[model samples]
Target: MLREFHVHDRKALLDAATQQGWDPLPAEELDEDDLHDVVGAVMWLADSGAEAEGADGLLDLGKARRLRSDEGHEVAQWSPEPIMEDFGKGWLHRASDQPGDSDQSEERTDFAALFAAEPLHCDDPECEDEGCLWQLTPRTADLLHTALTVLADEAYDDAEELGDKRLLEGEHEGNWGVFARMPKLTFAADLQWRRRFARAADDLADDLEHDRWPQPTCTAEELALHFALDDARDLHDELGYEDDADHTALPE
Candidate 1:
């Protein structure tokens, strides 16, 4: 039925299914919907430039041509694109292995000093009076932000696994509280950030009506710092830390 329907790129469809850990149905056994889904998946994978070589090598041209001809559809040929460039291809290779200047190392050390000197703070009002806000540091803030980003990305992956119907729930206390207490405010902040980062991308996608970039107003560093403080407050509330761990290391 799939072959008869002339579903474009049937082999590629089967290949994608195999790559996804699913046993590809024999061409003779596939129904229309199955074939349609396979074709759609293949097209999606190809468009995303995913590297998945299933049963056939990349771009199985023979199968593609047959499917397109059978379906009376235009067969678009896949081109081999250069993924990267070698700067020294046409130039002489400098053999001197002298290490580059240590400017970046010095700058990193200075940045670390600045980070260490900054006061840490908790977001909770109660903690503020007791100087509990000083429990979070710049490094911790970076870690917290990275963790949240990873969590969010995982949620997105889960949503995809569930067929894209999942409404992601914020797992972090800071994000959840802000989202629940002031959804509009949170949304506005997100929008503002997106607008800042998206200006350059928006220009590139001028021809596209719906192209958008993630908001990038506030520095990720700042967001991470705030997130860590908020998370630390939530932790304080939940864990009820001893005075030693919670206060001695915390800056006044």
Candidate 2:
């Protein structure tokens, strides 16, 4: 009957199977609707740059599910996620032993020293109480930021397993609360240190322009690094994770 109906009037057959009728329950004849949805989903995946099949030459349902889920979620909310190429090529490559690193090490000394120095302190003559913030340099700040960001953004499966272990150990704190704070703090501190690096970069640039440093304090690579850090800092801000005005580290 279905084949005959399809041969004569395919559109009428599809409507009869999928569209609402007096019956509340789905008609047993509605396999056509399921087939229609599956076919439509496959077409959408193809249009969205998704691979149609896996290595085994079978349709990849896992990818289809993920794409559908992401599309639904994105309609409600969106986030700026780290791109794999950006993380691997730009940030990780610089930190690893690459050809540019030899010169990078030598040039980074001055900025590294500045980064390693004690944090902001009160030097006011009128003030009786002197204070200091976290002893975080730009290098250390970058490390902490990268670690926490990866933990929150990429390593959720590992984090979930770790949470289970913590629960077994009788940890009173919920994993969600415990895991959430570090990324927030590190993100704030990264922005704070970016400003410091930018100022130092400007100072170094001025010194180089005026021939003040017979031995330049920072190399071109280090200056480039400072600007890169600044760009990352600005990106976080644009993503709506506003930098903490206090610029103080959260207690561990």
Candidate 3:
């Protein structure tokens, strides 16, 4: 069924299920809705230029429960999270690494500062006056964000997992706490910090554009990633969790 999309490179993905030990729909059942979804997902993956080899790990991300906007574009990443606290402000963007990481571990060297720094003024998130908010220093923010990102990931992993797609759109509107769902964005909850986070998200989007990052396509994988990243950043939010805003992060 996926072959109807005319994606020449799909030999890899089509054959992937066999190697991964999942059975494709039988020829007689090719017209089933489930098969159609799987095929559509595969086509979307093909359009997004995703490498299907690594996908051998899991195939359910493109499933119905995953996140994807109505647009063909997937929200694979949230590239700007201007974390603020008593420590001050620092930029954060996820790279499919733990949301705790400033970048990847290889790209990060804040450990020396992170370890030497003062412990969060209040390690307890539920502490009175919120001492945890004071720990938002660059190093501390990464540390804290990492901790929250990890904890959330663990809890949600029991929840589920998905791969990265990449969302780095244009200038996000911070006023109403709205950011680009495509490219990289979403509501930050703290309306005051929304401006900075919006800028940061825009800058990250620019960088991705300059680097020629691939645009998202209408595929199962890309769609799954977009929803995943959106959910990931929402977990560590200082304010916006309950205000009827959407904050999604990756499960995997």
Candidate 4:
């Protein structure tokens, strides 16, 4: 019959072993007697704080354990990358750099040339008229950066919708069908770029309202609201909202 060891038995066994100056038995060799002895030794060592060098070392070990557990959990919970798989391994590198492909490189070069050749109008009305808002503002840039980041994050889901919508419309479509149907990330980038442009317009409106620029008939607040409404109307029309044609367009 296997004997059960209790707290009193453990304490007594540990005390007897200590008195006899005998080393504790290994875990595999442990019966009721050994378990009692080990538990007593553990409890005594815990109370004395003599199991390790110092309290700081034990605290540090606890912190390390917690950090490692957190990191492991994060790794385990990681979601698969969405758009990266769709675009292929070389797509990002190729899209950004256009390396090795003369045709794509030339296209990028042409776009740069076109952008440079076009009249670079600051979206800020004040900047456009007087060039006062041209100085780079960190606050403005940070706001734009945050907005762009959010837009980029949302673009993957939008891109999926675009792809799925297109696929459903077609009778015969394959995996490549999704790719062919979706608007390019370039298109989403352009949309985000337009929003940044709108933000610049808004900043200019703010400056005007604050009397930073030449006097205007309407208060800056009024003009800003008007432009914002116009933007909303434009977006509504673009998104195919069914409204009277006259109601959606800006007044002449």
lDDT of each: 0.38, 0.35, 0.37, 0.36
Determine which window of 10 residues in candidate 3 has minimal summed lDDT. Answer: 243-252
Question: For model 1, how does the per-residue alpha-carbon lDDT over 1-252 read when each residue is reduced to its tens digit?
Answer: 011123356666566655755554567777876753565555445545564344233212110112223335443445365344553454342444224423232221121222343433656667655445443343333333333443334323332333312223453334333222222433324332332222222222221112221233345434433443466555445533463243324333
Clashes of each: 10, 0, 20, 0
Write down the lDDT that model 1 would get. 0.38
Q: How many backbone overlaps does candidate 2 show?
A: 0
Estimated TM-score for each candidate? 0.26, 0.22, 0.22, 0.20
> Between candidates 1 and 3, which one is better according to lDDT?
1
lDDT of 4 at 198: 34
lDDT of 3: 0.37
Candidate 3: stretches off by over 4 Å: 1-8, 19-22, 32-115, 118-176, 180-252
lDDT of 4 by residue, 66-125 (tens): 113323434335667532334234223345433233444222112122112223356656
Model 1 spans with C-alpha error above 4 angstroms: 1-25, 36-114, 118-231, 237-239, 242-252
TM-score of candidate 4 on Cα atoms, chains taken together: 0.20
Backbone clashes in model 3: 20
Q: Candidate 2: lDDT over CA atoms?
A: 0.35
Cα lDDT tens digits for candidate 3, 1-252: 012233344456666534544456567767755553356446445555554542342222221222224434344455375433462353353546443333343343343343333455655667766434443233333323333333333323322221122223433233112233323433223322332332233333232323322243434224333443455455456534464122221110
Model 3, residue 23: distance off in Å is 3.4
State which candidate has the highest lDDT. Answer: 1
